[model samples]
Target: MDFKTVSTIGLESSPVAQALAGLRANEARYFWNKYKHEFVTEPAANNPAIVARVNTILGERDTHFETAPLEVSDFEVAGVR
Candidate 1:
């Protein structure tokens, strides 16, 4: 597979970086082994459309969440969104 394994989120901070990396690796391994798909993640700041959609859903239910997300990941396979 030609995919990058570690997530870029929270890498600058020392405390959580290792744990996050392990989590990302574990998720990747699971998908790769079972579904033959690469698990990838991106910073939430980079995905406006997804953020908007999530916020819209939250609005419909009148729920209040924290201001921003630390990271956001999309789980997809076979080019489906």
Candidate 2:
């Protein structure tokens, strides 16, 4: 498959494209600097396990995240979950 940069695909309909892009770049930088690992993202619909894990954690604290996430990144960084 051909690699696609964020600039080359999507974002035309997003009003906060600039901010979202900045956040994405920040995530990449943090993971790279802290763990020397590449950041990864996948559609939330395809990753029920990740979603369930997050919800379970929040449930323990009785906290709720009202908005559903459109994407998910799952990985351990430097022994931290």
- C-alpha RMSD by candidate, in order: 4.2, 4.1
* Collision pairs in model 2: none
lDDT of 1 by residue, 11-81 (tens): 54545676767776777787788789866667677887778887898899998786565556676676665
Q: Residue 11 lDDT in model 1?
A: 51
Candidate lDDT (C-alpha), each: 0.68, 0.69
Q: Give residue 48's lDDT in candidate 1 (0 to 100).
A: 75
- lDDT per residue for candidate 2 within 1-81, as digits (tens), equals 011244412333456766666666677777777777887777677899999999999999999976676667898877898
Consecutive 10-residue window with the lowest summed lDDT within model 1: 1-10
List runs of model 1 lying over 4 Å from the truth: 1-10, 52-67, 78-81
TM-score of 2: 0.71
**Top of the candidates by lDDT:** 2
Which candidate gets the maximum TM-score versus the true structure? 2
lDDT of 2: 0.69
Candidate 1: lDDT of 8? 44
Give the Cα error of residue 61 in candidate 2, in Å.
Answer: 1.7
